[model samples]
Target chain A: MTETLSIETWRLAASYLFLVLLMIMSQLLKLGHGKEFLMATVRMTLQLVLAGYVLELVFSQQHLLVTLAIMLFMQIFALITIFGRVKGKIGIGLKKVVALALFVGTSIPLAYFMIVVISAEPFYAPRYFIPIAGMTVGNSMTGITLGAERLARVFQTNRARIEEALMLGATPQEAVREFLSDTFSAAIIPTINAMLGMGIIFIPGMMSGQILAGASPLDAIKYQIVIMMGILGSVVFAVYLIIQLGYRTFFNERAQLLGNED
Target chain B: MQNAFSLRNVTYRTILSIPSLDVATGSVFGITGKSGSGKTTLLKLLNNLITSDTGTVNYFGTDVLKIDPVTLRRKVMMVPQAPYIFPGTILENIQLIFNFNRKELPVQVEIESLLELFDMPGMLNKKTANMSGGEKQRLALARVLLLDPETLLLDEPTAALDDENARAVFEYLAWWVGKSGKAVVMISHSEALISEFGGSILALSGGQINSFNEEGSVHD
Candidate 1:
């Protein structure tokens, strides 16, 4: 047989092409809804290609300021994604509160671990800081979005029940007390289940990448454990803050559910 | 025993600009009209679930609009036409509004007392989600009554019950009204219950309370 490219290079190239083909097929088949999928593909390609060029520059310069700026930009972009998904389903004013809560609750602890615990010096080491921040912010964004969307939908659907409770002397929070657990559980379950399936079903991305980068399997596994714990922590903190923020939306001076938008 | 609640020029409209009406205290306050007459909207006004564009709601001769809404809520409660049961034990379902009630009436005591009063003592530990339609109605009644608001605004409390269950539910309510002496404002199409209650009945039509009937042949 004729000699061909090595297996790893061929695998990477084929997979990348297939990913594009899948995006095109999704649009062609009309199986997936919304123009967002096509838009998302375009966004992913453009952003990642731009990110690669920037990272090449970043790696060479390795300036702490550059790393910090990238981390800040990632956090802001994650916040906006969360805001966009949630605001479509709930109050738009809630977006600012959710974004702030997501950043403060998640980023604080994540930055702490990155600097104080991991103790990576120059403090803003792009390789360590950027990926970890991306992972933390990305997962927290999902958790917050799910939490906010579930809460808003529950209130909108069960508003009559809420009003009935108020009529019966329940505070707005107390009225929604039954629903809080439901929302919290809904928000966190996906992460928990993924954690459950992480090892037996499939290796997570970070650990797999670490192994491919020639780290010992055990070292990669330990890193995965630490990252998973960080993710769980970030998800929990973000969801809790959003719930607390979402509850306050229901009341005004008169203790009524602020007028339903639709 | 006393004129329990009052409303003066209590006007409510959707964002779509519907007109408002007023209601007085201690009226049997029959909110009856065609389906889209905003009967529920007007009932929501008394309960303060819906706010009006103009005018004030005065309960106990105090402008309800000015009072703390939480405080006002304790005074004015509603039993929706179709009862909704929270996902909990029957005792918890009944005590839905009492989440902050410090006394926390012993669950057994509250359930036993409410059930015996409403003739449903057997449903104490049952999950509210599984309750039958009649049971849900009784559970809802027990819930609102536990809070003991001065004005009870009921919207079709027995709408879905069988004739026997419906009669039983209304009888329980009528007996409770007599015993509690609170103003019972029920929105029902049941003329038999309306005439039997024998308080002032105001017929609502086209978003206005136009008929005040003292005595009329009552039919279901």
Candidate 2:
């Protein structure tokens, strides 16, 4: 395998020229986002540099406990981001349900991919585990957030039909089944579209990263395929779990459709 | 006869507060009040759609909270003011009850008779999306009638219909209660219709009972 060329610190600092050009272009166009763009660039650089150092420490330590702790931290961060993305006030009970769904949905496939699919040495190796977990959990976080928001919105809008069904002796499950299915479909469509456009429309970031790291194209393609499949599985599972459980929150113990007070 | 619904000191969200009320079987109970006087909220309470913040609501002496909501709703159905029309043909909407309960569909002859009774014979095959407001109201009534609940809590069932159609709906409902001996608690703004059909009336003002009348005789 050919060794990948490394960029020196001075040469790497040259990448800031692109941001300067972007700021200048924003100014020329009167877009008024020049300050925001500069701030974002600074934030991104700082965050990535901090992440690099933290990852280096975690990678060198290579302890199972450290790896699991990082995974837990990522899951918590993902859950918070998801809660932030969802519109309207979601109950703490519902938030717990979503967190649990996200956890189980991400962990199961992650374990399967690491243990059975790739069979990585020291199964909890930070290098393999962190990236795989990140990809799956990150994708599924977006999926569940979209699903929860859509479910809440649709349930509120179509409340009359749902209540009509309930009055006709339909259980809460039977009443909202169609809406739940629609939410799942909406949540997964983006991921499905991304999969469809892979390789032809654009090479995925993971695959490009693998190729840049001096791995053979075929080897990179194999890893990409497995990770993508893992991501798809995790997203579908998370969205399904969230919708199935989340829908019940919209009804009461007496099977009546609860109003969307929030 | 045992009252179909009984409430005592029932309160909800400061918009509804009933000290005591009873609706008996084989009787037409009329509810009258201005908009937002909790007219609809009273009907919702009968079916356990919304529980009271305080006090008790009972269906036939049994606490509504204790009964299985699905079973209670099947027995005591509420037809809202602006009823929802499911996406489908009129026939499908009418037949939705059977589908929901996993029962055999009603016979064609029975459906035809019901359609004829509701003055909707021409709408059996028409899509519900194509129905007018009044037609949707009738369709909603037809759909609920298919379930054959013992007590119907109707909120402005004829609000969208013309006088002729409204009278026709009331006439059918009068016949329905007489024949089946089922109870009805109806909220309406038409004082004439209420006086004509209501066996008893409960007038509300700002969520509190203003007066109780039997056979159109006001008694505070």
Candidate 3:
């Protein structure tokens, strides 16, 4: 296969013009986003550059333990992002539950994709492992965060309804079943919408990146299809696990609903 | 008559601190207090909705904390001040009790009878979301009555009703309690209603019982 030509440093730096354009537009419209835009651009560039160097070293080394360690780091970062994004106070136990859900949700599908589907030769090839894991973990993180937030909000706002169900002899599980179903559906909607619009409205980032890196369009499409399926599976699994396990935190062993103190 | 509920030194945070109280079947126990005096909190303790930091609440003879909360709650239902109507028709909301218990739903005639009893015969097919405050309260009552609880912990069940409707609700509750021999512990601000309907009254102040009047008179 022919190697893809790399962009010169000057050409890469030219991308800053887009950020400058955005800042100009923000200034003209008085949108108050000019500073935010500038700061975001700086952060993105610095983070990506550092990440590129780290990836280069990991790829060259091809050490299985190193690859696994990086994967663990990515999972931790994703979990932290989810915890940070949650709006209200969450119990420490619930936070651990969230992390466990993400781990199980992303790791299972990722293992299947790497071992059974792609059948990576060395099994932990960073080139194949990191990107796929990144996509799966990132998407599942968002899904679980949305699911958790929706669950908390629904429980808080509809306390009377939940208690009414409880009063009528419903268990905590039975009482919040509808809300859990709704949260799962709401969490996965963005992924469903993206699937609906893919190829027609816009090319997904992973597929486009693959194509730009000199992979055949057909090969890129195959990878994209499997990765998207893996992501969808992970998100569904993560959200379901979260709603199922996370709900128990809201109630005690006697099935009494825990107040705000928890 | 059996003692329906007995509280001893039940303190729930700073919201409530009842030293001792007993509610018996075949009676209506009125709990009167200013807002934030923990009237609702006391009821929640009886149903095991909230555990007290101190003391025991006994349902029948069993400590409420020792009993299965779901089982205890089924026998001691609570109707909050602002009742929540589940997302469904009035008929569906009434049938929800069976759904929760996993029992066979009552016949259409029984549902219709309940609606009639609640003075909401025309609302059988009406959506709960469209119900007025008074209608929702009656619907909530009808729903709980179908459960046939031994005790009803009502937080101002008729607070949203007009004078006539409120009177009708109390009368129905009185008749129902008399027929079933079930106890009702209700929170109410209306002195006249308390005097007329309350078999015994407990007035709360600053999270403690200020007065206990068996005659149901205004305690000053």
Model 2, A1-262: lDDT tens digits are 4688788899999988999899889989999999999999989999999999999988887798999899999999998898887635576656877898899989998999988998888889998999999999999998988888888788768887888788777889988887888899999998999999999999999999888888888999999999999999999999988898888888877786776221
Output the chain A TM-score of model 3. Answer: 0.93
Task: List TM-score per model, in order.
Answer: 0.81, 0.94, 0.91
Which candidate achieves the best DockQ against the true structure? 2
Looking at model 3 chain B, report the run of 10 residues with the lowest lDDT sum.
B211-220
Candidate 2 residues lying further than 4 Å off, grouped into runs, are A27-30, A87-89, A259-262, B216-220
DockQ of each: 0.45, 0.55, 0.52
| Ranked candidates (TM-score, high to low) | 2, 3, 1
What's the candidate order when arranged by decreasing lDDT? 3, 2, 1
Question: Per-residue lDDT of B35-105 in model 1, one digit per residue for the tens?
Answer: 76667776676667767767666666677677777777777777777767788888777555566433365
Output the lDDT of residue B21, model 2. 87
Instruction: Give the range of the ten consecutive residues with the poorest summed lDDT in model 1 chain A.
Output: A1-10
Error of 1 at A73 (Å): 1.8
Note the residue pairs that clash in candidate 1.
B81-B155
| Candidate 3 structure quality by residue, lDDT tens digits, B16-63 | 888889888886888899987778888888898889899999988889
* Candidate 3 residue runs with Cα over 4 Å from true position: A1-3, A13-42, A87-89, A260-262, B194-198, B215-220
Residue-wise C-alpha lDDT for candidate 3, range A149-237, written one tens digit per residue: 88788878887788778877899999998898899899999889989998889999988888888998889889989999989989999
TM-score of chain B of 1: 0.82
